[model samples]
Target: MQTITSARMAAIDTNCEYLGIKRLQLMENAGAAVASAVKERISSGKVVIIAGRGNNGGDAFVAARHLGGYDVTVILIGKKEDLKTPEALHNWNVLEKTSIPLVEFTNSTFFDPSILKNAKVIIDGIFGTGVRGRIHEPESTIIDLINGSGAFVLSVDVPSGFDPDGGEFDKAVHAGLTLTFHKMKTGFLSQNAQQYTGEIRVVDIGIPIEAEFYVGPGDIQPFLKRPAISHKGDAGRILVIGGGPYSGAPALSALSALRAGADIVTVAAPKNVSDIIASYSPNLIVKKLTGEILVEDDIPIISRLIEKHDVVVMGMGLGNADETLLAIEKIVPLCTKAVIDADALSPQLVPFLDKNMILTPHAGEMKRLSGNDVPDEQKERIEFIKSFAQKNEVTVLLKGAIDLISDWLEVRANRTGNAGMTVGGTGDVLAGLTGALFARCKSPLEAAACGAFINGAAGDMAFKEFGYGLLATDIIDYIPAVMKA
Candidate 1:
């Protein structure tokens, strides 16, 4: 009995496409389901469909084709050119080839109530999960007509003008039955929802369950569509703390953060390797620590920097020096949010674990931190990761051929990376990418899922061109492209 919000449902829809299921196929299944529901009410009659310009309308268009015996007529709320989605347009084109009478109401002035006057059944598809704000135009007029028609009303997905997420709407259609796709919407559980949605029916439209469980292109959209009015550092400000023994590790992380849409990134490393790390990218804001390596003395400066940045990407290559680990133990408690990785994945840091922290660990690192063997079987491994995350009170992003991400309650997997990603510095790229997403997303699980998908997808893209010779920097270069796609 899982209920999904409109936004999360939209993400799952996109993820389904990433997994090779096209939106048009789902629309066909939905239309077939709607047509079946109509047949249940009555075999054949004059059926009038009120459709908008989105996928909701597309579903209605599909239903019209299946409703062969009945006199099915489609009343489009807008012009065919005004269709919002390609799937909707495609269905409209298909409907045009058929004899299912099509009527277009370009404006409220042109809307004829007589079309619905004879409808023995009215299918409401004017709006679905995308409805927001007050009612307007031909939609408002059509909603009223549907509610007053006294016909046996069947709402497609959600009733028109109803807020599918918050269950708040200024004006909405009252339907005798609602055929919801995929799963039940959360808003339907709201008080007084039954008044509009008479009898609710959940329809399976061929969206694979893996689409919800796996991270894909869907997870990246919300973060990428930042406000145009946003200022500097609004996207994300990341602080990378690493680079005592190896300079390249921290540099890779800082650069990857920038490519992953972090507005600003500062790499704080030991003074000895600061110059080399800084030389890697002029775009990086390098902070020089007092000594040759991370020590207890640097805590004061690091603490202040953590306060300024949105999230901390720590432990790329500080080595296992007692003094360095001790410094990390103290620094972990100061940050509100962080991505702890590599040498920072020590058992000692577990005492400070919280929901705000994300630990990125390979199988070996996970074993060391959890004091348990990383299971060989996939199901056992997934359960182990979930148990470890729940016990530690932190999100775990376990790196492997199949990346597993979990935040106590739920687990997600990403299978985007290839064998070529076994190359060095790739994990550093993931750590930094996770930090950038962690700064923007409300859920640590979502941030970790998105990070794993984007990082691995970029590697897959780079592998296509460079094969096994792909470098971590090559993956970094493709980060923005993955986000854009």
Candidate 2:
């Protein structure tokens, strides 16, 4: 009964592989499910598979292999060389070695509508959930042909051409049945979706629970991609407010923010530590605030800086002085979005937990703010984190051996980190990484979840060579590698 967005489904698929479930194995299961669905409808006939050059097509190829004795013919909507995924290409290679009739339509001119006239059942695997916007070329022509053919049409994943996220389309296949995978697509719940989807069956592709529940490489994919024509600050412009008691923490956060793909990172530190923080990196833009520590007088200048930045990553090493805490109270309300961490995680900030803030807290800090101990048991901890996020209406990134991220509605646990990450400044790195992601991400929970995953995964990579000697700076150095992965 649960529904997932196509984007989330793709994330889950990638996570499944991260957990050792290969794409080929999932394709086999999906195809077998499609083949079984066809058999249930009608045993034997001239079954025509209309497939695209992606995973949807791969599923059709697997189904064709499974329907061995039946008269199955596969019509690939694009050239074999154009198959998009390795799994799709692998299945196509398998079909090429078989005796099944195969047809390839590389262009619009190659389509033959009359070919569908005699098809007892048409498997529409042209465009699963990935497609959006206007229908193109052979796929457009083929959709019309399949609709007019009057065959028992079974669409794979989703009705081809239907926007599985929005439930709108330029044109789509009118399937008699839609064999969706893993879960019902969110788009199918729309009022008009049933016209194209018909009877829908949610197919299980054997995705592990860890894939959906845990943060992995899949969770960060959307954030890593950039538009070709993006401007300088399109990634993120972060304003880090820390330092005073210690300079290293804020500098680490600022450096990690840049390493995590933030375009510009500025550090606002007390005049004494400002030079020291700036000396750590030539890249950082340091704004020196007056006095030994943050005070109410610095609020005006900090407010101006906050307006210029996309997100405020605050409280890395700004100690718990009363004047400094009062300054934090004023500055936090000014931030449109913030990643609150370290000494900044105070009960005074609770009233301002307006869902725009991401709170990253270790066990002691979390207990300080929530007045409750973080349970050792994972289930109880998850519920505790979720409940806190819901009640506060804020995103919570609880840092521990198992990082827990929650935005009330959904809770994701990240298991990418290790014992080596207990290093002092790793939490600062995570706070900065989270600030970078939160600036661009639509969901605070997603940004926190992916940030935790990236921070820990990078730590894991650093641990490979550095072992227990892994430093927080080492984690920052490997951020791009983790993103690339």
Candidate 3:
């Protein structure tokens, strides 16, 4: 079971050409799978297939044709003539010959609840992986109607109006089941998709196995699995530094690292907070640093401590100061695998970065590091981050509405995490998770990507129970659940 982003899936579609498979054949298989699943679930239900203008709608069209014997109505949600794909148009032409009632909606006024009042099952094909931005007015209204219909809504591919890679959705269809073809879309497992998607079943459409090698979840699972004969030291050791004014931040990171499968976690903080951190978790080994504020003189002791751990998580709650920045600049160069995050991120520390380091920065942190604001548009931000990561020779996990991870070798997006994760300490947890992964992963880039995905997914699971009131501790509690999923 592999999960891929919408853009990566699109790349796979193109790669299929090399295998002598046309896009139409894939769509046909996808539609057949959806139809088969529907038939198996509800044989006598009146199926309402709500299709859009994209290839996803084409898949629904194919399902409509296969299930034409049943009471099925095909509702096209866009200008029928504007469909871009030849395969989609072909399916549309085939639908015209069927007796299944077909309706078109060019504008918001066309959304009529009466059309779907008799539907026992609704097939959502309104939008697919490529959809971004807020769903338009009529579409939003239509989605709301389908959600409130009390009918079993089966989504074709991914739920329409949801970002397949990652990010919050303005509007999306709530599905009882999501029938995804070939592989699971990354969005289906992301934070935003949880509300809209349920019981995601990946249907094999016979995509070549070799095609998977080109793009997929690139080696992130090693960190999730435990070794059979692993001892405490074998699981990986993590050292977390930072904690003066904001003591809980480093503690949160240390706890998350432990939850993420790190066997040994050590926290090196000011003496005032060392006992406070140790009291939270018995697993933590606290080292009290004798300093009012971290300075360049602390680098020698930090360098010695780095030798005792596999990876170091730094910068959480470390107040931004010239002295702190100087200490980070000196310490980061000495450490092999380090997560430079929070207040530790500064232009002064860039020269110390190497491929072994992971820089976890939010939008504001990224702006400070790069001296340019990340644009609201996801694609633009992804490109900018990729360029920046490649230039710096370090993996950059740019935390935003959609987390984008980039190293010189590859770029990936993690669309996990709910609105509830906006609270403080979550970022600290993310840094801790990354540090733990870095201990097991082959490279810093792989650790950073997996860390973001797992951290955000854990947040999504926490949101199920806690909803809007979720805290960072809730996310840590759900870490195992996300890994099991």
**Candidate of highest lDDT:** 2
Taking all chains together, each candidate's TM-score versus the true structure is: 0.97, 0.97, 0.58
The residue-by-residue lDDT of candidate 3 on 346-408, one tens digit each, is 989888888888999999999899999888897698789888988989899989767888895
Tell me the RMSD of model 2 versus the true structure. 1.4
Off by more than 4 A, model 3: 1-220
Q: List the residue pairs that clash in candidate 1.
A: none
Q: What lDDT does each candidate get?
A: 0.92, 0.92, 0.83
lDDT for each residue of candidate 2 in 291-364, tens digit (9 for 90 to 100): 88999999988999998999999999999999999999888889899999999999998987778899999999
Error of 1 at 206 (Å): 0.8
Ranking by lDDT: 2, 1, 3
- The residue-level lDDT of candidate 3 at 452 comes to 88
| lDDT score for residue 418 of model 2 | 93
Better of 1 and 3 by TM-score: 1
- For each candidate in turn, give its C-alpha RMSD to the true structure in angstroms: 1.5, 1.4, 17.4
Name the better of 1 and 3 by lDDT: 1
Task: Between candidates 1 and 2, name the one with more favorable TM-score.
Answer: 2
